[model samples]
Target: MNDTVPPPEVIYVDTHKVACNGGGGALGHPLVYIELGAEGTAECGYCDRKFVHKDHAHEYHDPSPRPEGEH
Candidate 1:
């Protein structure tokens, strides 16, 4: 596993779906992330905002179901 510390990184995923703070609301849910690169640098990273730590974000799935023909 990677041993790293968290930092304040910039994230803009077009929509709040990746919003860490409660769906772009004032709550601020801080997108999930994992350290990449040599250390705590942009060299490499996994942030939920950019499809990183996708599993973590899936902790709570949307209660609503998909459309009749959708999965």
Candidate 2:
């Protein structure tokens, strides 16, 4: 039995900071704000949704690691 779970939903944002409400109306969790900080990536604690900055989108896709501040 090799059941694989899919990755969490990803959202591309223009800013480094964002707020998430789960997007499920009454079923959604409380609104929480996240800061991407230096890494340029943040994930929602309530929904595990990944928020990636548009400028750092390449880091999320490319597995190879490169120099920092290059992206």
Candidate 3:
């Protein structure tokens, strides 16, 4: 059993909506838009990169409750 823990690739985002295309170039995929939603994080469908909001940097493990008045 491999107990190695690979470091998560986290991209801090300011906006709730983010577009990802696997960073383009050689290893890239079709563009897709990811919405952070209430969790304040979204993962790319192609590359599986984790997108985390700046506000939720500390509580990355346990996502905080969504802010009031947000859908």
Candidate 4:
């Protein structure tokens, strides 16, 4: 069986700046603020969650549904 883990979740935003807390609550990680690069993309250091600018979000095809309350 393949042991590789699937990629972390991806979230799209309209702005270059965003904050992540691994979804908050008991399962959450520490809060972190990230700024997307000129390419309009960034990844959370703690959770590895990808943040993509809305304009570029379409470039990636994420079959998974977005989490509730995420942009």
Candidate 5:
């Protein structure tokens, strides 16, 4: 068995308030609202997906590399 661990998915959100339902599909879960506190990041309790504030995306493990001042 492969012991390598895959990286967690990171979503950059513009607003502090966000709703997650496992992306809404066959593997989706109940709709839930998540708030990004002062830390500027939140993880879905059901899916474990990481939501990072767009302004602080660089601070997290974001796959996309964005230049300064650019969303």
Candidate 6:
């Protein structure tokens, strides 16, 4: 089966947003955001599968700006 996803790359941590997750200091998603650096293998935390390319990982990113036009 073939699924489409963005190619994996070395993403760097650009900023760390510290917000209180609903409770117990948990996070609804990953606690970090990264900037893609170079192409590489991508990993799926859900199934622990290694995707060699972006199309294989089935990952998509929305680079839309925030409502307040924040980056």
Tell me the lDDT of model 2 at 40. Answer: 84
TM-score of each: 0.19, 0.72, 0.70, 0.70, 0.72, 0.22
Better of 2 and 6 by lDDT: 2
lDDT of each: 0.35, 0.79, 0.76, 0.83, 0.82, 0.33
Candidate number with the higher TM-score (1 or 4): 4
Report clash pairs, candidate 5: none
Q: Which residue pairs come into collision in candidate 3?
A: none
**CA displacement after TM-score superposition, residue 25 of candidate 6 (Å):** 31
- Candidate 1 local lDDT, 9-38, one digit each (tens): 433232223324324456455555334222
lDDT of 3 at 58: 76
Highest-scoring model, lDDT: 4
Compute the lDDT for candidate 3.
Answer: 0.76
List residue ranges in candidate 6 displaced over 4 A: 1-37, 54-71
Poorest stretch of ten by lDDT in candidate 1: 36-45
Flag the better candidate by TM-score, 1 or 6. 6
Candidate 3 vs 6: which has more TM-score: 3
| Model 5 stretches astray by more than 4 angstroms | 1-7, 62-71
The predicted structure with the larger lDDT, 1 or 6, is 1
Q: Taking the tens digit of each residue's C-alpha lDDT, what string does model 6 give over 1-71? A: 54655322222222332222122344334433222324434343433223333432334343222455442
State how far residue 1 of model 6 sits from its true place (Å). 35
Clashing pairs in 1: 20-29, 20-30, 21-28, 21-29
* lDDT (tens digit, per residue) of candidate 2 on 1-71: 74744336778899988999999688799989999978788878889877889998877864333578653
